[model samples]
Target: MKKKLLVFTGSPRRDSNSAILAVEAARAARKAGASVEVINLSRLRVNPCRACDRCRDRGPGQCVQKDDMKKIYPRLQQAEAIILAHPVYWFTINAQTKLFIDRWYAFGADEYRCFKDKKVGLILTYADQDVFSSGGVNALRAYQDIFSYLGAEISGMVYATSAGPGQVKKNKTALKEAYNLGRELVS
Candidate 1:
């Protein structure tokens, strides 16, 4: 069976550097024979978790909110692999990405069983010279902890410093890394 990979783009800006890399990765994943879907979180109306603990009462992957995330839940649960591509803002993951991830709390009702053994990939684009200066490390660290807690394997990460939109196109190394990450996740 073909591996199903879900790619989430967290940039609010259109054609953002991170989104560009995500597209590149998705293209490569498809070429590698994996079934891939790329969802733009900024285009969705995903609300923040209410901390109501209602999902725990209901069951795994259940949320109280009636929003677009209702559609994402099934895809997220069924995917064999997932890729999160975003830009670091305020020294951490952007609000869009954070909000989407926070909603994953619903999966916690089942101890994140849906994530066990799942392959994960990360692509981060920042405006500084390096990860440390851009605070991209903070986001990476958070993902490390988040996926580790969920028993998901982080297959790869590609981070680049692109000061403006489309600048990441000049970063061949990062682009190559993103392509490799996609292929690796499904392989």
Candidate 2:
């Protein structure tokens, strides 16, 4: 069966380089025979986590806040492979993306467990090689720490370094890496 890969973009810019790069990766995965879907958090009306803790009491799928997150929960639960494509913001994930990650608490109870044995990847775009502002290798590390607690394995990550607006489209090397990641997702 073709693997179901879902790419969630956290950048506020709907068509940001990171988002486009994710699309490219998904396209590559499709060509390699894997089913792919991309969700742009910036465009969706995902609400912030309410911290109601009802999910903990209810067992599974119990967020009380009625919003776009309801749509995200199911997809994340069902995806065989997931990709978090985001731009580096102050050495961390963008605001909306970070909120989504924090809201993942609804999926875990005792010790952080959800979609066991599933594969996860991080895709980041930076504006410079400063290793700080634009992001260096630490971007992947931040994602690893969170996913590790969630029981997801890091299959691979694609990074576009020293990239600016429209830079990703010209970054052939990064694009190829994205394509390779897509192929690997299904392989």
* Index of the highest-TM-score prediction: 1
Per-residue lDDT over 1-187 for candidate 2, one digit per residue giving the tens place of the 0 to 100 score: 8889998998776348888778888998899888899888888886778888988987655678787888888777777888888888877667878887877888866445456778887788877775465654676667777777677788888887645566678889888888778778767
Q: List candidate 2 segments past 4 Å from native.
A: 110-112, 130-133
What TM-score do all the candidates reach, one by one? 0.98, 0.90
- Give the whole-model CA lDDT for all candidates, comma-separated: 0.94, 0.78
**Quality of model 2 by C-alpha lDDT:** 0.78
Question: In order, how many clashes per candidate?
Answer: 0, 0
Top of the candidates by lDDT: 1
RMSD of each: 0.7, 1.9
Cα lDDT of model 1 by residue, 76-176, tens digit: 99999999999999999999999999999999889999999999999999998899989999999999999999999999999999987899998899889
